[model samples]
Structures are given as C-alpha cells and as structure tokens.
Target: MKNDEGEESRVLLENYRVLLKKALDYLWERIKVERREVKKGKRVITKVKVTLSKKEEVYKSLRDELEEVNVLASHYVDKAISDAYSVLRSWRRRAEKGKASLRKPKLKRVYVRVKSTLRKVEGESVRITVRPYEYITFSWSHTWFSPRVKGLELGEPVIKEDKVHLPFRHRLPWFTPLDYLAIDSNLYTLDAYDGEKFVTFSLRELYSLKFGMELKRGRIKSFASKHGRKGGKLMEKYSHRERNRVRDYVHKFVNKLLEMYPVTTFAIKKLNKQEMFQDADDKLSKRISRTVWRSIHRVLKYKAPLYGSLVKEVNPHLTSKSCPRCGRVSRKAGLSGVRGVGSPWTGN
Candidate 1:
C-alpha cells in the first residue's frame, strides 16, 4: 500500500529490492559445483552437482556483513537470505537438467517476505511490524473474499510495490480413490478410458484461441515494425488475452472432468517437451507448444485434491504401440496405435 508521500513507496520498494539483490549476490558467491560419473545400463554419464552455502553459515556471515539491513528488523535479514537461497536452489535444479546456464541469477522483483512472527491480527485489521515500534495495518472487513475465508488460517504476508498480499490456508483430509482413469493427451483432444469405455474432451476452442492469437500477433509484429509503441501495446494486449483465455478454457475442462469422475485415480502420460521438440519437426513442435501439454496435467494435479481425486503420470514410451485388449507390444497392437491409447496399468 502507498504511504502519504509518493516517493516513500518508491523508496520502500527500492530498499527491499536492493537488500534482496545484495543477499542473493552474497549467496551466489558461495556456490559449489562438483562433477561425478554414473553408470546406467551399459553407458556412463557425467553429472554436475550444484550447491549453495549452508543457511546457518550464511546467516552468521550476513548478520556481520549487512549492517544497514537492521533499519526494519533483524528477522528481515534472515528472510532475505532465505529467499536468496530459494532462488539458488531453483536455479541449481534447472542447471542440473541442462535447462538453465551455469551462471549467477539476478533477483528482479521488488517485494519483502513478511514472516508470521512480524504480523498481528486485530479484529478486521492486520498490523505488520516494520521496526520495533513502527507498523503497517490493512483492513479486510469489507473485502469481497473475507467471508469466504472465515474459518481459514492466515499465512505469511508478502509486501509488494503497491499492495500487501495476505495468504490463507485451508486444510483438507486425504481421500481414497475408487477406480482408475487413463488419459491420452493430443493436440486438440484428451482421450480417457475408465476400464469399461472411453471419453474424449475436445480442446478445439483452446486450439482456435491460440491459433487466432498467433495470426493476430503476426499482424501486430508487421504493424509494430512500422508504428513502434502502438503496435507493441496491441501485441501485449493480445498476449495477455491469449494467456487468460487459455487458462479459463483449461480450468473449465478440468472442473468438468473432475465433476464427472470425483474420487478417481487419473493416469496420464508423462511428457518431456524438450525431448519431444528435439525429435519433432518445426510444424509438429509448434502444434505441441500451442497445446500446452503441461498445463492440463499440472492443473489436474493441483485440483485433484479438491475433488478427492489423484493423478499419476506413467512413462510415455511405447504406450500407444502396446495392445490394450491383450498384453502384447507391436506396431499395430492397440486399437488406435497412432493415437497412442494404451492401458494405464500395463502401459499397453
């Protein structure tokens, strides 16, 4: 939230950004890299292991090095260090997978990670401590979502440039699934089998939205080459619309599917987009990219718990080539080998 003076907000955001970057740089300097060889089947592969300095060790060093960080509280320094380590950990994972370059990461966002200890609840107001005596309060009494989260627990708040985001957590009990549903994802449809029969969910609307936006973007690019800012804004507008529409379509599809088959274990093929792109032609790669294969699986996973359902990703290798009727692997074994419709349990 903005303070009385405009410059105060800017200063506050800048201060946090600077402190986070400083902490990130400090942790980045202490990164450790090691090489090791492992044998798989008949081949030996070299792997790289990347790590950062221990949190306790870094905390000790930061407390002594960052003297100016005490303007807010001692805990803020610890939070910054923790956030920095999180960034490094993510980068390390991507680097190991050969998805990211082995280079230092830069923290570009302006925000402060407020811990639970620094927050106090007073009726409808939440007061967050900046210093020992100074605090900031936000009211949620009149907010639209306040009633919806009546019994939920408030989590740690994060401070952004113009607002403070308060998170709420709801606990749900784990459930036992009744049956299994196998899914086959394609460019414009998702085919599912529930042991007895098959069901196909059409994704033609999503495909059309993406395809139409691509054409619009192409036109925008040509216009942008002539008129800079106007065309750029048009391109950005369409981009945002495309993302929102795609997300909306995916949510609706998942919601409908979960409604029909609640408390069921859904089996899906685990797809590797990077490997797929490397093996596919440019046209096929573009189509796969438009399909956004991971979005459906990811949404299904997160929303599964809400519907008392579970999603399992099995290996995609030779799934379509295996016979569904009988336990056999052949080029023309399955009913629709081209579609790669295999049994989830046996990968048929």
Candidate 2:
C-alpha cells in the first residue's frame, strides 16, 4: 500500500514540475538571450511572443513543441517583419498587456542558448532543436548568433525528467552524540567553518589538471608572441580548464571536510546572488554541478542524513562585519579601518 502511494505521489510531483517548467521557460528563455546581448553591448528586455493551441492533444507535447519553436527562433527572426529593436518593443507592449500567446506569437528576440542535441540547419541561418518528450521536440534556428556564448554547443537541449523523492540523508538525532567537526566553504577555502572545527586544505591539490592547462596556455601565448600560435585561443581554452579546476577544488574540499569533520550541522556562508547561471540545460552546463556550492550542499543533504552531519548556512551578512565587542560594523573587521573591531576569540 505504501509503495503504491509513493509512486502516485512521485507522478503527481513530476506532472506539477512539468507544468511549472513550461511557464518558467517562457520568461527565462528570453532572459538568457538578453543576458548574452548585454555581455556583447547593452542589456535590454527582449520579449518574444508564443502561441499555443487551445486544443491540448492537438499539441501532444505542448512544452516540447514550444522549445522546438525557441530553437528555430533565428529562422523566424530572419524572416520577421520587424527588426530586433522594433520586435522587442512590440513584444514588450503585448507582454505588458498580459497577452503573450504560446501558439506561435511573434516575439522580439535578442539572445539565444545552445541546448542539448541542438543542430543548426546551415544555410543562411543556424538552427537547433530539443527532443523534450520521447516523440516530441523543440528547436531553435537563427542568423544573429550572440557573441557572448561562453561554453555552449548547439545540440539537442537536455530535458530533465522531474523526480521528487525524500532527500536521501544520513544524520543522527540531537540525542545521539559524536565527536567530529566540519567547516563550511568561503571565498578563501572551500569549507571554512561547520560549527566546531575549521577545515583547511590546499586548493592546488584537486585541480592539478587546471594548473597543467595554465602552464600549457602560457606556452601557447609564448608561441603566439613568436608568431607560432594565437594567444587568444590559447587563453580561452586555458580559462575553461582552470575554471573546471576550481569546481573540482570545491567538490573535493566538501567531501574531505565531511569525512574529516563529521557533525550534524554543517555551517556555510550563504551567498547573496541575484541570479545564478547554472549549466543544467546544455551538455556543458552539466559540469556546472562542480562549480556551484549546490554540489556540496547536495552531497551533505544525501550523505549527512545517514551519518550525523547536517548542512547549515551562516548569516553571511554580518560574518566579516559586526564587531562582537560592542556589536559595531566593519567590512575589514578593524583590520584595515573600521570601528569596534572584535578579537578572534569572540565566537567568530
């Protein structure tokens, strides 16, 4: 009886996720495109219109079909009656009126992303597609490709099948006692403080590959200076490699911290970010799991529940500031120039 109930609940949650995902994709897709444009020149609100058939079955995979439309948007834009600026204005007006349709409405587009299995129809324009459902697909095709494409390949967009299960964890109750500690992550080190002990490790150990790439890039740049290679391409390749090193640095740090300092509560610095661009949609985005702190949190969530560690976020606002002596505020904590500098022994 419980197994059946669990299955039903999972299905319901997945369906709910699918519905919300569609609505989010509508607004989010445009934002991603605009961000790329902002990186190129300026930031602008680009709205694209979409039209959805009122008939449900008529659009077997409605959301998937919309994605298809997004991929082929460049093709549409090329053939659009309005230019990029003009179409954006038109889209804004209609969106303000809350009349954006999902049934192939004209949308002013300024940016686009390369999703999974995306293939560009090479001719006068480039096109891409996403196979969302088993038999359904979403696509994008365009001529005005944004230059701010960092790490992306035009292929089929990866569609994550939603799954909501009890977060797998390994933690003991408060009643159970153990002698272990783990520090959280910060800008300096991966895990700075958990609650009891400070976890410290070298960042260089995990990202040896990155260090090697950096050395290779330096050689390439040197070669370029001697008219043998292009430094720009070499730098680009090296930067990505180094960034991957940082990601692995965090992951290894988190795992080691957890193992060394076993505790029920893992305290970490809560980062304040307006928007985090995670690479979950594209093939490369999959590697984003390593860069973001989300990876550590995920591990703690799953592994801690079975053990005794529990992940917790510290109030990053007053961490470096707020003198513990008189409760004054300082950015450098009186190290540089500020008032009410508390001592290191003040329960920091």
Candidate 3:
C-alpha cells in the first residue's frame, strides 16, 4: 500500500513539473518571436522597457493554456511568465553587449521554478500546489536541513529530476576581526598572509587535472568528427565528468580553507579579468578560462558567512611591484623572491 502511494505521488509531482515547464516554454517562445520581429523591423525599443508592456500579454496567454492542465496552479503560470521575462531581458542585455549570437531563446531542458509560497510544510509531509484546488503531498526527510531551514526565508524552489531544491536565507550577525588575512589569488596557487604567518595552497594538481581533461576532450572531438554519434556521446560524458570533478575539488578546497583558518575576516585582490586578458594570446586566455577563479571566489563569498567570516576585495594595483619596506614602486620587482613584505599587509 505504501509503495503504491509513493509511486502515485511521484507521478503527480512529475506531471506538475511538466505542466510548469510547458507554460514557461510557451511564454519564452512568444517573447523570443516578438523580440526577433522588433529587431527585423528596425524598431528602436528601450531594452529595459521591452518586456514591461509584453508581461501582461504573455501572462494571459500562458494562463489560458495552463487552465487546460487542471492540476497546474494559476500562480505558477504567472511565475513562469515572470521567469521567462527575466531570461529574455538577460538575453537582450547580452545581445547589446555583443555577447549573444543566437536571435531566439530556446528551452533545452525540463525544469520549473516554484515560488516559495506554493510550498507548505505540514508535519511529516510537504504540500506543493499543483493547481488552485489540487496539491501533491510527499513525505520529506529534513533530518539535516531542519535546523538550517528554521526561521529563514525560502526563495523560489527549482524542481528538476524528480526533486525540489529550496534555497533559504536569514540575517546573520556581523563579524568583526582584530586582524585580517590577505589572500593573493594567483594562476597556480593561493598565497595568504595573516599579520604573523604566511601560507600557500598548491593549485598545480588542479590545473594539471584541467589540462589533462582538455587534452582528452580535444582528442575525443577529433575522433567524434570521424565516428559520428557514438563518439559524440562519449565526448559529452567526459565533459560532464570534467566539470563535476573541478566543481567538487573547488568546493572541498574552499571548505577546508574555511575550516582551517576560522578567521573573522578575509581579504582578496579584485581582478579585472576581461580588461587584463583582452590583448593576451589565445593560449593564455584559454588557460585562464580553464582556471576556476570566479567559482572559487563565489564559493568563498557565500561559504565564509556560514562560518561567521566575511570576505573583502581590495584593488590589486601595484601589489606585486611595490616595495613593502621603502614604499617604493619598481617595474622589475618580481613576486617570486619578495617575501615577508609588511606593506601589502597594511590597511588600504
């Protein structure tokens, strides 16, 4: 009896996801078609206001179709419209910046964004709205998440692969530290200096792994060009593995750093990657792209707060060339030999 109930609940939840995704795709398709039409007609519409007037039209159109899927909620249809508009605006901005090559936005996967209000906790099971009068309730094991979810505002949930993932936020107490740890993030490793001690973490292994994967992918692509479909599948499999491996390593490295230091405040240099690499060689640019610097920064920013730590970014001007003792700037001062310099440790 329990197994049958579980199977039925899973089917209902999947149906709900499909309905939501359909609505989102429908709204997105309409918006993309209209945008292309406007561009082709040489209409000069302010990018910011592009979606504002079309929001109601898109919502109404999606609402009419969603009503046919009786189990799909009305509020979710509105949510889908809002989500599609957000994506469209992002694409428009990208196009203006010359970064977008495609004229139309496409939905390549099945996913839906569920508003937090539509999810209600009821004792052992959570009730998620499918429609105005219909709901699908499923038992959830919040053993580890119970404490974290308490007294926090939940953001929009993402439903994918038969699972609902919720994001929570809460006000945390501000952290203050008597001393600061300055971190110099380099291409190969992270060098950190706290008032009294200096430490470095080797990132060479990670770089090696990335380069190895890149070489493998290159060979795979070359093989795929000759062998066709099966080779293409193998290429995708390896690509996903590479990403997962890099992401996993970065997370583990950052977690260990936070655990080891337990510092109240951390500082890092602000790097303008685009301007720095604009005139660089393609090989150098590819190397930099393979390095997951942005991901490292993002993980540190969010994970530091959980440990009552704060992260700060300072201008990196003259960090490597400036002398610590005499307060002099030299073009020949290399970062390799210069150590125990107290100037970089000084307040900004």
Candidate 4:
C-alpha cells in the first residue's frame, strides 16, 4: 500500500491526526454548546479519493500520505478502528507472530456511494480506477443515499458534478453509506428494496454447499460411532475442505452481490442459528435461517459501503406467516406468525 518509502503513510497519518482532530473539535464544540462531555480521538473515517487526471499533482501528496497510512496501518488496523492508539495493541500481537509480524495493510481508496434519481433504473452501478498517487475514480449509475440524510452537510467532496447527483448527508461520509441499506436476505434468494422493487435473484448455491457440509458432518458423526479411535484424522480432512469451500463460496457470492447492487439496501432477518440447530421445535425453519444472518451481514457490512448502499436487519417474525395478499393478521388459518412480519416501526 505504501512505497518502500513508508514515509507516505506517516504523512497520511499526520493528515489523519489533523482531520480526526478537526472531527473531534467539531464534536467537542457542539457538546460544549449543549453542555456535554468532550471526547477526542475516537473514530477514523475511511474514504476512497478520486482525483481527476489534471489534478494529479494536487492529489499526489495526499495519495502518498494515504498510502503511508495504509502501510502503517496494514497490520494495526483491520478496516475498522475508533482510535489509532488501539492499532498499537494489535501490532504488539502481530509482533508475536514473528518477523513478518507486520502484515502489509492494503491501500484502501476513499469510497463514494452513488445513486440515481431515475425510477426506470433498477440498481446502482459503480466504476472505479486506481493509480499510485495519480488517479482514482469510483462512479455509480443509480441513486441510493438516504433521503433522510440528504441536504445535510457531511464533509463536502473535493470535486462534484451537478449532473451526477450525489446524495448529501452528515459529515460522517467515511461511514459506508451501505450502513443505511434495506437488505432482504434469504437462503433461497437475495432480494433488495433499493427504495424500489427488484427482481428477486437466486442464492441457492450457498445453501447447497452449506447443506452438503451439514450432511457430511452428520455422516461423520455417525461414522464416529463405528470408528471412534480409528479414523480421527480422516474425518478432519473432509471437514476442513468443506469448511474452506463454504468460506470461498461466501466470499464469491457476497462479492457478486456488492458489484451487482452497489447502491442497494439489505433486508435481513436476525436469525438465531444456535437456537436453530440446538433446538428442534422447527428444524426446517431454524436451519433455513441459521447461516443467513451472520454470514450475510458479516460480508455485506464492509462489502456494501465499499461500493455504496445501506443495510437494515428486519424482524423475521411473520415473513411467511401473514397473508401477502390481504395484509390481514392471521395466526391459525394455515398461516403462522412464528416467522415475523414487516415492522410497524419502519413506517415511522
């Protein structure tokens, strides 16, 4: 992320200290006016900077500085950190890992979430280009920032085009805009409400892998009953491959979702997978939701805003229980509220 000349990171960090200081100062002044406590040095905003070809020199130093920050932080910061000091503690742990203790942190460009205003458009699209201290660009084709946060002064971008509509929000621009998306994640599919409806798409590949893994585990468990002390290492190999396959599948699947729906929101149900597998009240229901919440949420958090979109975890209390046709409340007539329904709260 940084040149052999790591000073760039030092410079960028110096800049971070300055910008972060300003953010703290901004917060403190507001708190003082409101009679609140002043806390400094609490957060770092991750941004991907885009510099036009002509302004390359103007952005060069800044780019180098940012790379230096990446180099210095590669080992210390694993993407999210509230305080730079915490980086020291993590680095110390890395030091214990040996000479290669400092893993080179990849350079992260500032991110801009773009959304379009045209309803005819189905989703957002982002195009990005990167060069060392020269040019970096991320472009979007659809509209998606929160209307709630629009018109507020977030940190202003160094460059903006009026024809390219960028949503306005608070100064917390570094916070991935996807933090505000509405995700409708399911085992069978990944649907979105990007302030508009979209054709539901299939995500059963993940399901098939996970299901196969579970079946393999079950088979191994049964095998252990017959060969407990005899085949310990044999089963571990099979389990390891299945687990890796699951991880790879998750990575590829989520990456596709991010690329396809750059400004899309996520709507997911908070499923208790532990309760799902551990208890058998409704085995199918629990298994259906078990892997969804954590896996999808984990990947999408960074992945979504890395492009631009928000994610909202909805209650799955009556998703399948109530009638979609009538919007009537029902608990017994072949329908069950055990799953969950749309929040009476989101409307507010």
Candidate 5:
C-alpha cells in the first residue's frame, strides 16, 4: 500500500534514529565517567577545585568517534554531537538547580537535528540531505501556513519518525511600554490592575474541572487495584485529558489577558512553590495545585514577546496588603478605591 518514496523515508528515519541514539549513548557514558572523576576528587579535599573537560574537546572526540564507526555524512555527525551537548548542558543546569535526578541522563526521544548545511530552502519547499547525495523535499505550498511564513526566516529542522518540524522565526522591533498591567493570581480568580481600574477573571470553572477530575481519578484507583491494565489505561486517559484541558484553558486565558493590554508591560507575583507547600495541609495543597499559577506566568512570559509586551515577576511580599494609591503596606488594604501615587511597576 505504500509507495517507494514513503518506504525510503521510513527507512531513512529509522537509520537516523539508530545513529543518533548511538552517539547520544556514547556521549552520556563519557559524561558519567567525567562525573565519577569529579566525585573522586571531591572526596580527597574539603574544597576541591574541580574542572571538567572543555566542550570543544568533547565535541571533537565525539565527532571523531562517530565518524569512524558510522557511514553517515559528516554534517549528520556534527548535528548529533551538537544535540548531545545541548542535552548535557541542560542536564548540568537542572542538576545545579536541584531539578534533575541523581542518575545520568538518557536518550528519551530519537530525532536528528538538520543544520543549515544539511538543508536547502527556497520558496515553499525545503530539500534536506539525508546522506551524501540523498535528499528529502518538503513543501507546504497548498497549506494555510504557507502564506503566513512568506517573509520569515527558517532555522534548523528536526526530523522525527512521523514528521519533520520546521522552525520559522519572525523578527519584531521593540517598543516602549505605555502602562503596566499588574496581575495577582489566586485559587479561584486572577485580579488585574491596569494602572487605572481593576479587572477580575474568575477561575472557578478551571478549578471545578480539575477538582472533578481529581475525584474521578480517586474513584478509579479502586478499579485499578482489581483490573490492573484496563484501569491503568483509564487513569492515563483521564490524566492526559485533565492536562490537555487545563493547558487549553490557561493558554486561552493568557491570550485574552494579553489581547486586553497589548504592548504593555505585565507584572505578576513571583511565587515559590516549594516554600508554599512546605507546611501546607492536604486541602491547601489541592487548592494550590488547581490554581496552576506557574503555568499562567510561563505562558505569559513566552507569549509576551510575540505581542510586543513584557512580563515582570514582582515580589509577592505584602502585595495584596499594599495600597496602590499611597504606596503604603497596610494590614487592611484591598483592591478597591485606590488612587494614583506612582506606578507599582516602577518600584518593582
């Protein structure tokens, strides 16, 4: 049922996956060896000066090792090594931030990064080189996004098993902001103060959806104990459904807020989740989980660049109790009947 070109594409994808995985495994092994050496050195001194091997040296070694064993083009090996380094760098960063696991990182997804040297683009089509002379051409001439990306610049492409993802970047000029929209996120509401008036976006529906899903999952746990496989699938389905629905709601809510105050700098509270949950009770933790304040902040941060706006995370200390009019922290201050003193955005 499949054509020759489709079959060839499938085979190429598989081969690229295998080759990329092999290179990543070798790089991870080398990283573990380096980590072991560092640990051994630290055991000898109270404050050991540790220095790992340079990235360029590791990259050169990886490229040389991969080239000697694989028959792929040199650029493929280069891109794979680059991706491996990216992974390694990300792991090191997360480890420093106490966000990564103690175990070494593993290759979770198989994909090839196609650099500019491995791809040629013109008009609506891109020709990607798979090997020395072989190529795969992709075109979006008939699709809706074709017209949208007419003048945008194309960056590196990623080749996955089922599809190739093309990244298009648009360069926009920066502008001076006219005003600030200060937003305070709570369990059931998002309050916005736009330097003049206040607006409240009720998050009752979002909270209700999450709370209902949590109850459903709780009830299914009993069924899961009896019927393992089928109940596990049900649990996964509901979990994914909850995640997707929450994501959709957050995106839409953030988009609406951004649209309301376009080109303005938005301010939000910088919340520390770990500190918040340190002494929180079961009910409080569930309420905090349903609020999903971080998702709102993250979506706003990333999407603000596109809207010519900026996002600033202000300190949460005494924010709700601070008077916006006189710039005074009061024990009984609220959001109503506050006149202008100075912009809260300036102090933050």
Candidate 6:
C-alpha cells in the first residue's frame, strides 16, 4: 500500500513536469511561426489588430492541443502564451538597438504559471489543481508568511523545481513629510545630506566581495576549459552564491539606514546607467555594472512606505560637479578630486 502511494505521487509530479515542458515548446513554436509570417509580409506587427490576432491564434492552437495533454489547464496555457510574447518583445527591443543578436527564444527550464482560481488556500496548505479532478496539496510551517498572505491579494503562482512561489500585491499608506534626506549614491559609498547633517555609508566591502568572486570565476573558467562539465557546475555555484550575498547585504544595509534615520522623505539622483557607462573603461564599467544601484533604489522605494517615508528622484545633472554654496560648476573637481567628507566646494 505504501509503495503504491509513493509511486502514484512520483507519477503525478512527473506528469506536471511533462506538461510544463510541452507548454514551453508550444509557445516557442508559435513565436517562430509568427516571426516568419511577419518577415514574409503575410502579417503586419501592429500594436492592436495584428498583435491581438496573433495572440488569439496562439491561444486557440494551444487550447486545441491541450486536449491531448490533459494535465495542463487552460489558464496556465494562456499565461505561457503571454510569457512567450514577452520574451520575443524583449529580444526585438535589444535587436533594434543592435545590442543583441536576433535568435528564437529557447526553453532551457520549465516554468508553470498557476492562476489563483486553480489553487485554494486551506489553513497552512495550498491545494493546486494539476488536471481535471486531480490535485496536489503543499503545506508550509512558516507562520510569518500567514499574516502577509492574508493581507494582500495573491497573484498567479509560478512553479519551478519542487517549490511554488506566490506573488502578492497590496496598497501602501501615503507618507506625511517631516524631514527630507538628500542622498548621493556613488560607487564607493552613499553620501546623504539631511539639511544640516551629512552621513556616508561605505560600500567598499561590497565591491571587495564582488571582485573576489570575479577572481574565483576566472580561475573556475580556466579549469572548466580543461576539466569539462564538473568545473562548469562549480562556476555556476559560486556565481549564484556571489549574487545572493550581494543582494542580502544590500537589503540589510538599506533596512538599517531607513530605521536609523526615520526620515519622511528620501531624495535620490535619477541615474541613467546605460548612458553613463557607455563610454566608460572596461574594468570600471564592469565594477559599476555589478554595484546593484538600481536594486538598492528599488528596495528603498518599496520599503520606504512601511516606515511612512516617500522616495523622490532629483535631477542628476551637474550634481557633483556644481558647488552647492556658489552654484558654480567646476570641471577640474572630478570624482577623484571629491574625496573625504565635508563640502566638495571647500575641499575639506
């Protein structure tokens, strides 16, 4: 009896995995076919008519095919169609800018998007419909997630590996201003000026960790060239570790800063990263690319409301070059020249 139950569970999981792969393949094929039609002048890629018509065709085709693959739901098929178009759109944008080589989207991994209608939350467990009259329930012990889960409306869940990730949406309360902190985000540190007082958070350690990871990656690559697939896995493992470490550090740092200050408003410079890094040197550009400034800004913006704070983007033009006191732009006082605390104008 135990062996029979275990075998049934394994089969059910395998069926879901197979369905996900088929969905991915079906979407990719549709995209390729549409692209060929566009090139042959049989179809026009318009914002409304053509786009809607193509999507309808793809959705209908998938729906028809899902009769054979009975385990996959219609809503999940629709989501896959949307995901395929999203990938194509992104690729088209990059190709237009000559930033990437044009190629069809590949399915290296399986992702199944499950709508809320197909999943039910019962106590600590979520019952998901895998097929008609077939369901699977997953339980969790994380009590901390219960309150957040109850508060917000949950979006479609994404299934990857053995775990399901649920996305939630909620409205945040508006902040009433008490004080503003003007922050200048740089490569080495975040320089913050709250009218009379100035504070700097050093990010040198983050950069150091990044550089160390890069060094390790280089060594791993060299070994991979000689030792085959095992070395490649090692490289991927280290790369993932490095990314998680940086993300964790940034989250902690931002949380601490917001807690310490308790400011009502945050003023940060609007960063145009692409334009800024276009002409920069290779090494410096790589370092800047790994800094995760955008991630930090996103974290700050989202988390600020929880503390009754609002984030604002100020114009970055001549922010560092111009002296705050005299309002004069100094061409000679570059980033290197503006070292060590106090006013850049006074050079203290």
Model 1 per-residue lDDT tens digits across residues 11-44: 5557656667888778777888888999966888
Better of 2 and 4 by TM-score: 4
Runs of candidate 1 exceeding 4 Å displacement: 1-22, 33-49, 53-78, 93-102, 131-134, 176-179, 312-336, 340-348
* Cα lDDT of model 2 by residue, 1-348, tens digit: 012234433433344334334433443344311111113235454444433223333333444544443433222222221132344445555554446543223322222223323334343223333223212222222313333332333332222233211111222467433443333333223534334444454433543454466577778777767764466666677778776766666666567666666655655556533222231255433222223455556656666644566665656655555443455666563344221111221214
TM-score (C-alpha, index-matched) for candidate 4: 0.40
C-alpha lDDT of residue 44 in model 2: 55
Using TM-score as the measure, the top candidate is 1
The digit string of per-residue lDDT tens for model 3 on 157-217 reads 5555545666667767775855667777766778777766667877888889999999999
Candidate 5 lDDT, tens digit per residue, 252-340? Answer: 98898888888989888888776666557877776776678899899999898788899989888788777565667655534455422
lDDT of 6 by residue, 164-220 (tens): 676666666665778878777777788877667667788888878888888888898
**Candidate lDDT (C-alpha), each:** 0.76, 0.41, 0.66, 0.44, 0.72, 0.66
Assess candidate 4 and give its lDDT: 0.44
Give stretches of model 3 more than 4 Å off: 1-85, 101-112, 129-134, 141-156, 160-163, 167-179, 195-198, 269-274, 312-347
Deviation of model 2 at 157, angstroms: 19
Pick out the ten consecutive residues of candidate 6 with the lowest summed lDDT. Answer: 339-348
Clashing pairs in 1: 320-340, 342-348
Judged by lDDT, which candidate is best?
Answer: 1
Selected candidate, larger lDDT, 4 vs 6: 6
User: What TM-scores do the predictions have?
Assistant: 0.75, 0.35, 0.62, 0.40, 0.70, 0.59
Cα lDDT, model 4, residue 44: 45
